[model samples]
Target: MTFPEKVDYVIVGAGIHGLSTAWHFAVKLKARGKCDGSKIVVIDKDSIAAGASGIACGVVRNNYYQPAMRELMTLCVDVWESDAKNLHYHNVGYMQISPKCMEEDVAEIFAQQ
Candidate 1:
């Protein structure tokens, strides 16, 4: 593979955050009549999602207590559910076992869900 001698943008990682940032930035720049994404380059020591994003330990749930967080989670859930194939989103059910002190908050979260 060959890379250009000079590029407008250089992204260090190909992980989720890096790709998302580069994509959104490029979109905004193009919308404003700025540079196209051709000059942008994404480089990673390893392959894409070679970091924590490649791990399977993370969990996304709508179990937050705050209103804003809950709303954000709702949007995230929608996005995840919408693209199950490419995103590899597993809809495995979640189970939460908390102590007595968290019973109220847990119940509230359940109600919200």
Candidate 2:
């Protein structure tokens, strides 16, 4: 189809991040009666999910060396949990199998969270 001359939102990619952001925006706009599919446009050089997100194995984990990363991951997990069915997410939980040497470090990270 030919592209429209104007759009309310123009998403640059169709990868996980872009798609999720677009979905959230569309949801909010619809609630405000400000948008429908016609008002939003997602432009991607490749097919949806054909970028790094598609090649990378899907693994949701809260493990991170930085507190900020952990917090962000926690928030992401919450979003996934909120719409597990719609998002096709399996909240079966994650396991971090570590060697005895890293047990203390892992424990410390867990404690911080």
Per-residue alpha-carbon lDDT of candidate 1 for residues 1-113, written as tens digits (9 for 90 to 100) = 59789998899998888998889888998998988887788999999999987885767877878989989988988988899789888888688999999999999888877
The 0-to-1 C-alpha lDDT of every candidate, in the order given, reads 0.87, 0.86
Model 1: how far residue 75 lies from native, Å: 1.4
TM-scores, one per candidate: 0.74, 0.71
lDDT string for model 2 (1-113, tens) is 89899887899999988988888899988888887757888999989888998898777787787899999998988988898999888977667899999998899888887
lDDT comparing candidate 2 with the true structure: 0.86
Task: Count steric clashes of candidate 2.
Answer: 0
Residue 99's C-alpha lDDT in candidate 1? 98
The collision pairs in model 2 are none
lDDT of 2 at 78: 94
The TM-score obtained by model 1 is: 0.74
In model 1, the runs with Cα more than 4 Å from the true position are 57-59, 84-93
Q: Which 10 successive residues of model 1 have the least lDDT summed?
A: 55-64
Candidate 2 stretches greater than 4 Å from native: 82-105
Q: Point out the worst 10-residue segment of candidate 2 by lDDT.
A: 56-65
